[model samples]
Target: MRPLLVAALLVLIWTSPVTARATGSVLSGIAVEDVAWDDGTALQIHWRTKLDEDFRVLIVREGTDGLMDTLGLFPANVQWVVDDDVTPAGTYRYRLSVFDSEGILVFTAASHGLASPHANWFHRGRLGEALIILGVFAMILWGTFRRRDIYLRPIGGLSAIEEALGRAVEMGRPVLFSAGWGAQLDKPTTMAAMNIFGWLASRAASYDARLLFPTHDAVLMAAAQESARESARIEGRPDWYRPEDIYYVTGSQFGYAAALDGIMERQKPAVNLWLGTFAAESLILAETGNHIGAVQIAGTDSTIQLAFFLVTCDYTLIGEEVFAASAYLTRDSMVLGGLWAQDWLKIGVAVTVIAGLVGTLLDWDAIGGWLRGI
Candidate 1:
């Protein structure tokens, strides 16, 4: 019976697959690789196992001091682990050990070569976006040199600036302007508002209209004063520039709003130009202007305040329209070119999104895959 059993076992071993017969080592294909397109702080450890028995993997790294530090003990089912604790441009060596259910080491392996983390200069995944930006830059340069008129859609809020000033002139009332309490001159929204303010100051001087600007920041008050002075000089009405009129109000948000409301009530300005960043006070100011029967033109980058402005103001410049005001008002070739390039880029993005959706619906994975790769 023992001889027969031995013969059966030998037959089973000989006829079985090579993988089953080659169970001397439970682990195979152990490798270490540097993670790509990263800031050079990670390494990936990869391995494979054929054994189905309950086991765990112990990963260790040899430091520069030649001391082995155990990374962690992971389940056998985990095929890869990312070591983000690695330093940039540092060499590393790793060893992996396979242990059985009883914590007995079964097989051990090491990376074939030394691995070092490196920082890539450019991200390959964003290559498509880079190309699109470069194309837009080239278009801007071409448009700059061509010196052709770039057509821009008129913004009613911006177009009415002159008409608002004209109404102020007709009514013999002041044109009140504010850059809001939420921002300073350093903010882009405030700077954009300053651009519009400069142009409005010049026009106000030309129309001999009273222009009042109040601010919640001292630096912004100084900037507005400079802008008004410069505009007055440009319009050849330096006497019309009133530095006192462009004054600093309190820094408190609600206090500033209340002061503006009082000004609107007492002065009864015929036109109100509210631009820049605003928060809760947007509704307070706009509602006051509406109550006084003023022609209000408002603009802001704050989405939260935009709804209030839209409902209360006569005309509102939303989002990027406020940024485009300087270019639209001045008609500078270079600035207009930037606007054109931005529009074209938006169209391209929209088209790409539609194509990706269509490809997904048709079960054509190539288009979606290419877009994701980019």
Candidate 2:
């Protein structure tokens, strides 16, 4: 009986390939890679496993001390999975393991990888965006060095500078320039206003006319004083600048408007140049200037305030025209160059947008894809 049993076991072992190895596995080619176009929070895992329906794949994630823990079970046919809960710049390891019928471990394929996802510096999906930005800036900087002429369309508000100053001079009244409620010299609107203010101060000083700046912010007042003095000096009328001319009004929004309105009613400035940012006080100031019968010239980036000024003021700088006025009035080489670069960039953007629209309508993706890839 012992001889018969031993012979039968040996025959079974010889016939079954599973006895050749203690455990057998058929999972292979497992890999991990970063997910594209994301903010570094995802990873993709890919693997090949036995295609036979008899096998199941286990997705294993790393635990502490490099221990493996089963994340989930998957069908053998699944080739890839995306893990979006991973942390950025974190290292990780994953395994694709196979199991056979009767719960026997069959095979495993591991890949030590990372959660270090990257933000696409230039969203290749946006195609020509980065290229356009770089090209525009490069052209602007080049304009600064080359001292080339940049053609710009005539802005009515910018062209009115001399006429406004002349009116102030003729009327023997001060020229009022105000950066309404949100005036912080560091802000973009205020900075642009300063550029135009320099020209205003220079022209006013040259004409022996007074320039007034009543501001709600102390910082803006200080900047305005310095700008006035510098402009006076540049225009060869150093004595024309008075520190008291740029004064700080109350910080309260409506209070500031009331104070300026009083001044407008009493002093009746010949030319009222409203620039920078404004809120509710925008209409208040414009209407007061109108009531006082002053020649009001206004520019602002604030859409709502700009609309008010357009209807109330004699001349208005619409939207980006305020920034453009800075370049046009000052004629600084760098600024002019920036304007030229910006215009060309706008043209390029318009063309691309039209092309993209046409392509989308016609069912052609090449134009859109190429721009985003750039």
Candidate 3:
């Protein structure tokens, strides 16, 4: 009976209140969130340490099965470590270990999982974007079918284009067409500039007029060449596409100005059309063209440059009129649709502004407060 009691007492002693202790500081397991899988085949794991827990360092481990079996330790934070580069795109398991003020309390590590690949737009969303594009195109087609005779408000600058080319022809001199620095495919101004170039080139070919083009952008140069060649062909003068005439000037902003200045001083063109985007170079080019007795007609949407052109050139197109040139010149369906859309948008904006002012005067707070409280 005593042997039986001794064995039961030993069992109770072995099972009851088993406590394990360590001398170092105790660390709570790391807390993590907002895991991002980037395109570079990497996973980013972010975590925060326990609040008010004093620790000598932090240890992070990545494991395939999330059991710190194959462990790795992240370097100290004070070393300016970039931890993101080492993390791979797979099931990433992380464990955090630290020493606290009291003792070492190592908690179990938490794991987050994700797969990474190229970002994809949803098929439905892609379809929607396609539909929006098609809708825009359809509206343009509708505008074309229901075409109205748009009496283009006369632009003094546009009106001067022919006269400028004609003046050059009369003097047996070259007509200089600078699409301006603004005539880059990436730039909104270039579209307007190209439209003007098309018109000018056609007129030049018809009159056996010499056309000279200087471009500051490679894209603009290519476009200007195509437009000039096309215009000449349309004018039944396919042989008139002069490669040397439409040449590239330096791409540097002021470098172009200086190159053009030299050309103007040398060729002394009879007519100069500076159309497209211009910057500080606007005045410099126009002034040089002016000094050569060229009939300078400049058009730009730049408000700052308009004043300079007005002072120097024979005629200038200002602000929105410059944008309107494509619609006026091409009479293209899309361009017309854009113009119409803007017209309606402007009307809407005007009505909104007016309504806002009137509502303020009438004390709109009563309506706003009622809505807010409800």
Question: Is 2 or 3 the stronger prediction by TM-score?
Answer: 2
Worst 10 residues of 2 by lDDT: 13-22
What TM-score would candidate 2 get against the native? 0.70
How many residue pairs of model 2 clash at the backbone? Answer: 7
lDDT of 1 by residue, 1-374 (tens): 74463344334423553232225767778888888998888899988887654777777787565755567777877888998888885788887766677655566667887888888888877888799778888876775566668778778988888888888999999999998888787798989899989988999999999999988999999999999999999999999998889998899999999999999999999999999999999999999999999999999999999999999999999988988998888788877877777677788779978988898899987867986676
lDDT of each: 0.84, 0.78, 0.67
- Rank all candidate structures by their TM-score, best first, as comma-separated numbers: 1, 2, 3
Ranking by lDDT: 1, 2, 3
Runs in model 3 lying further than 4 Å from the true structure: 1-89, 96-108, 112-118, 122-146, 302-304, 332-334, 347-374
Best by TM-score: 1
Candidate 3 clash pair list: 24-104, 25-103, 25-104, 26-103, 26-104, 26-105, 27-105, 182-277, 183-190
True lDDT of residue 198, candidate 3: 85
Clashing pairs in 2: 24-106, 25-106, 25-107, 126-372, 127-371, 127-372, 128-371
- Would you give me the overall lDDT of model 2? 0.78
> Residue-wise lDDT of candidate 3 within 1-374, one digit each (tens)?
74463344334433554232443333332333322334343344444443342432333445455533222333223312223433344444454443344433333234444323232333442464577567666655665565566556677777677677778888999988887765577777777777778887888889989999888887778888899899999999998888789988889989999999999999999988887778899999999998989998888877789999999999888878878887876777667767776665577568756776677789875534433454
TM-score to native of every candidate shown? 0.78, 0.70, 0.65
